[model samples]
Target: MKTRAVRMYGEMDLRLEEFELPEIKDDEILVKVISDSICMSTYKLAKQGKKHKRAPQDIDVNPIITGHECSGVIVQVGEKWKDKYKVGDKWALQPALNYQGKLDSPGYSYRFCGGDATYCIMPHEVMELDALLPYDGEAFYQASLGEPMSCVIGGYHANYHTNKQNYNHAMGTKKDGNILIMGGCGPMGLGAVSYGIRFENKPKRIVVTDVDDAKLERAASVISPEFAASKGVELIYFNSSKENAEEELLALTDGHGYDDVFVYVPFKPVAEMGDRLLAFDGCMNFFAGPTDNQFKSEINLYNAHYTSTHILGTTGGNNDDLLEALQLAAKGEINPSVMVTHVGGLDAVADTTCNLPGIPGGKKLCYTQFDMPLTAIDDFEELGKKDELFAKLDESCKAHNGLWNPEAEKILFAHFNVEI
Candidate 1:
């Protein structure tokens, strides 16, 4: 099969080219990738290339395709797995396959198996680890976003508090407790806030803070306070950039502090602020991954000694978390569309992935079968004036509160005369 994908040849060297894919082995499967969500990790990989642990050292000689967060339809099933999986089944992938302690993964290590392609092969290891998950959602973008949402779920699951009687650790967030999410207006941070409000071990109140007023406004609009009230949770958006913001934020909790605090940005001040806002047995989660190896933040050790305040960190989610993400999305309990801000085609993957950090907004979603530039949903109306395709897309998205949805995806595919 011939596939067009963005492949990494060396450090900061990415190419969009067409190539023939070798036939899938009996233990492998073939899929027609529909949608992929660009991640910052892919930007890091493009910059680091062979130096990355998951990237093969011989990438210059043998390039690997570069997208990971994707969802698609099974086109061909290998004989070895025909009984387990069949053609025409929708699927989502959990890419963090720490298989047998090996660092290699789909998007970083495989030549013919990645998301930035019209078609790709799934190796046997993916099935062996059960990383290829069955998805029955109407929208493929939801499955593509499941990977990031799962990481948010994992962070929530990783939080733990201590039992005073035995000094034992209790898993998960405290139920009916006050929660704080710092620097929470970006894509992942928005996911954290959405999940916290709908989570089973629900928080009584969720306070989300961010430095940018625009981001805070967008986050509030996407995940409204009315929605939180309907879910029996109190939601508040605070601007951390304001003077005496910390003091003002604390006053909202009646000076009791928070039972659970999450740091969504790698900024040291935010981390330290989260530490100071901890309640007696509060569990603080550092959710953002920093590029610096020596990233440090000051912690209130006095609270750790006198109270039961502690901290932990999570980089990604496990398989169980991905499953939960998929289940919640399918059930309409959580809207993954809130994370998506831009839409593009496979032609835009390389450039978008290479400069992801420079672009402001949330997830950049791409469809693998067409050619279109990366355009923000917020700018759809302006772009629509020049092209009817974007006009229809703008109409569809605007009908859904300026968020990407199944109707918008359908409109896009229909414009390209491509069947989903």
Candidate 2:
């Protein structure tokens, strides 16, 4: 079989080409990709290309497809995996290959096994780790959102609540305590907010901070303070660029510092601001990763010793977190759709991924089976009149308040002329 894939040939080079895939080995599984969500990390790797730590060593010999957050249906399962999986099974990917701590993963370094394609091969490491997981959900975003949602949960799990007095006090976010989400207007931030309010051990107050008021407003409409209040959680949106940003945040926390601060942007000043937002024994999660190796930020060590404030950072997520994300989503406890503001198809992903940083949305969901360009539902009203295909999508999303659901996905996929 031949798969059409967008491959990274070198720095600033990505090509969509058709290639004959090798026969599936006895231990391999072949699957057709469905929905995928573009991540900022993919943009980071795209710009850095061969220079990226997890990127292929030599693009000439090892060009790979990009993107890790995805879900798909198993079209053919290898004989070895047949007992555990079937041809019609659905799955999500953990996407982290901690193989002896080597930098190898599907989207970043595996050419034929990545998610940004019509189809792919599952490598030995993926099978060994059981990352291709069986799932039960209606929206493909459940599978696509699993990796990122796991990351949000993993960040919480990775934190440490300090009991030791002198050298260090605590780690992780305080359970049922005040929390701050820095740059919380983006896709990942929305997930963090959803998880924060809906978590069993919910916080007293969850503060979401951003520089853009419009984004803050839009976010408010999605995960409204009214909605959060129903769950006995206070959700507030603050524009950090304002003069009273810190004071306002502290005020929401009842004059005490935030017990947990999650920094969603990688800029030094934001990190610096996040450091200041930490309270005594507060744990800071630097969620957004910077590309530069020499990037440095000013941290308050005196406060670290005096107030026991410390910080922790992590990449991707582990397997268990994926399952937890799926379970929570299945129960309707958390809405992953809030993170997605745009939806398109495989043809749009290449361009959308390249210009992700500039694209103004939370998550850009892509359906691989269709041939549509990157299009945002917000613009549907303007474009719908010009095109009937978009007219249907706009109508569907309007009913859900600009959110994409299984129905919207089905409507959009049905517009495709050919069967996939």
Each prediction's TM-score versus the true structure: 0.98, 0.96
Instruction: Name the 10 consecutive residues with the lowest summed lDDT in model 2.
Output: 163-172
What lDDT tens digits, residue by residue, belong to model 2 across residues 1-420?
Answer: 999877888776777778978888879899888878888888888989888988877886778987789998888888888788888788999998787678688889987887788899988779888888888888777789988999998887777667664656344467779888999989899999999887766788999989998999999989999999999899989998988777877877778888888989988988898899888788888988887888889999999989888888977788998999998998888888888888777888888888888889889888777667787779888998999877887888889877877787777667774233
By lDDT, the best candidate is 1
Clash-forming residue pairs, model 1: none
Q: Name model 1 segments beyond 4 Å from true.
A: none
Cand. 2 Cα-lDDT: 0.84
lDDT of 1 by residue, 134-218 (tens): 9998889999999999999999999988876896777889999999999889899899988998898999999999888899899
Q: Pick out the ten consecutive residues of candidate 1 with the lowest summed lDDT.
A: 161-170
